[model samples]
Target chain A: MSDIPADLRYTKSHEWVRTEEDGSLTIGITAHAQELLGDLVFVETPEIGAVFAPGDDCTVVESVKAASDVYCPVSGEVTEINEALEDSPQIINEDAYGAGWLFKLQPSDAPEMDELMDADAYQAHVDEEDH
Target chain B: MGNKTPLYAAHVEFDGKMVDFGGWDMPLHYGSQVDEHHVVRQDAGMFDVSHMTVVDLRGAGAKAFLSNLLANDIARLKDAGKAMYSCMLQDDGGVIDDLIVYYMTDDWYRMVVNAATRVKDMAWINKQSAAFDVEVTERPELAMIAVQGPSARERAVPLLPEDLREPSSALKPFFAAENGEWFVGRTGYTGEDGFEVVMPEASAASFWKALFDAGVKPCGLGARDTLRLEAGMNLYGSDMDETISPLEAGLNWTVAWEPAERDFIGRKAIEAQKAEGKARKFVGLILQGRGVIRNHQAVNVGDETGEVTSGGFSPTLQASIAFARVPATIGDECTVDIRGKGVPAKVVRPPFVRNGKSCID
Candidate 1:
């Protein structure tokens, strides 16, 4: 299984959202998603301050061969965007969880994190997909 | 069951993104395909090409057999270790597969065919060899690696065993030197100077790791496709398959017509079509605007309409380019239908990029 930090909550769409102590959540794609997509050439992230409903299409990740849509896992307002990706889109491929984080959001409901997959459950989900 | 190459485990070790390509578990890329593309164009990179089958044809009639089997004449291989690129065709002039025939001796010739076409090619070769008493042996004991780029030869030459160093280093383009069981040929699919080395399967892992340590980046099929397309080389299934003729796929140059009496299998049908004129012609296109051109995109040339056979962003050119099969009579201007809208394009000869530079102004 890929390295899944216990502090982060993950979505089935292969995105990880880490809830910071200040009640903000930092989001990015998971290692499995980046590995499957190969090298990322372009990424279209959601705008800062944009409010999104859970399951809404919020971003796009395009590799050399295919394109994938990144969905919002929880209803939240995007507060910040990773401007670093504009010049170094490959940072996402290199470090999907940290420096490659896509956006920071002010969650409409902090309790929503309970609905996301825990580290162990997410690992099991990824492992079950290996077959 | 399909066979896996010796580098299969190594690919997983590198955590390469795997895909089922032509039936083999092959790496699509290690991490970033764009980076890998730049690695080859600017520096050095290697690909696990062992999935490609290397078969040896031997017998007194080996030359005669190939001369009849392939569209190109093998009798021209006067010197041993010389290689000839040819297209094998069906009786109806349809492409069976395109391959390289290496002349090792008067009685021994080595043929390397695409990975996907191995079974059909083996069966066909065996059938044809029966008439000439030739023996067809697939060499699965070997693994193949393609080290490519401007700096490829420099990096790969020093990694060779001492016995192979001198002769292999002195080998010319399209020539190979066989030292014991090791075969080093100055060849590659990417449009760059490099070597395609075939060595014993057992030693492949160590050699691959050494090349990696020498700074030869590990690339996968993704970079290979873009590199070949930018170089104007055709992919077997996408450009032409069992139903497509080489004439329509821009491979007419590979067919030899001399020895008028020595008819290869596909000659008659091709000759008949050559007389009547073929309908479609393969040509390269440069996107005139911002959109990325892609395969299956429709081409609009007045009353003529065709589809893109292959298309991608050319890293070297920094512009989208494509190959399309359109009406043979179409001119230098056309539009590619992308997402319901037509995008203007200019027709051009391929090699969109060469040696890490733009092929166009």
Candidate 2:
């Protein structure tokens, strides 16, 4: 089973979000997403200050097996990108939830966060995918 | 559900992430694919290749039968226990499969072919054998294990039967020795010195356990692919199929053209193609920039476009590499389209790495 922190929010596409003190949201793929991808060899982060609508492909994570797109969970402006991943993509495979965060976004619509699934709901979604 | 090998239980016990491989449930990796790849290149690793099809050809006409069947002349394997690599071809010059034929004796020759090509290969072999009085027997009761790397022989030799140790150890490359139920060959796909052991299916588990206990890391299909790719070895489905010819697939050396009177399947078509001199060239590419090269990626060589057959990030070189079929006039410089962006690459001769060392300059 993959780790799903109770305090975070998730999308069916597998990106997890945690609201920062400044009301900006920090986002990264869930552990379950990374596990399914195996060992990550490359990560292409979206440019900072770029705006994206919900369901936009904002990033790409490539493993030895295949490449995957990381979808944006909500309409938002990218405030920061994970520069660490440029040299160390395996951090996502090692600690996907904590230090492996992909980017931070300043949400254009805070109410969209409420529409995302909670930890329990995301866990159920992962279980459905497994079966 | 996919079929399972005799070592399926061992794979599950070792925390293998199982995936369906050519209708067989096999491990894609144990935990980390890169780790397994490094283990095979640096030290020793073992792979359960029991899913590969093993066929034994026996009859007074076995030599004559094989001489006409394979692209490479099996007559070169005059000594017992000698092996020859050849591509079985269709009448249209397309490859049926590439296999290793080992001359065990005057009456018997053993062949190991790709697992995915079992049905077509057997049908073709059987159909061709009718005129030669050769018996085509598929040995499903046997299991195969490949122990590869620099230290592979030292680790595996101790586990063999007492009488076979000396012969197995002294076996030259591309040679095999049979003792009782054990058939050991000093051959591997990893570009490392090692042995490929074929034994009874019932004894596979215990042998695997003994090898594991001797510190041979259990590798999976993922590592096997990367190792082979780095060694410039071709995968049947990815590099070539029924539609591809050996000449266009960088296997020209395997074809024997001497003794013009002797004929083999697909010989006429290949001969015509050779006479025309317009066959495409197969070359290796080293990605000159970021991004991993993948299969089916578009490659631009001058004005003509080509396609990548087999490609990946080579762990040994720590750079992206691939095999591409380009126009015969292609030069050293080319570009590959990765996600719509053209990236620079350099074309070079293959065998990017060999015997734990980089073959590229």
Task: Score each candidate by Cα lDDT.
Answer: 0.88, 0.93
TM-score, per-candidate, Cα-based: 0.85, 0.98
| CA lDDT, candidate 2, residue B78 | 86
Off by over 4 Å in 2: none
Q: In order, what DockQ does each candidate have?
A: 0.35, 0.72
Candidate 2 — which pairs collide?
A: none
Note the residue pairs that clash in candidate 1: A39-B32
Candidate 1 lDDT score at position B313? 75
Candidate 2: chain B TM-score against the reference chain B:
0.99
lDDT of 2 by residue, B111-165 (tens): 9999999999999999999999789999999999999999999999998877778
Interface Cα RMSD in Å, per prediction:
2.5, 0.7
Error of 1 at A120 (Å): 6.7
TM-score of chain B of 1: 0.97
lDDT of 1 by residue, A29-124 (tens): 998888777767667788888999888889777667866788888889999999888656679888898999999989998778889999899888
TM-score of chain A of 2: 0.98
Model 2 docking grade: medium
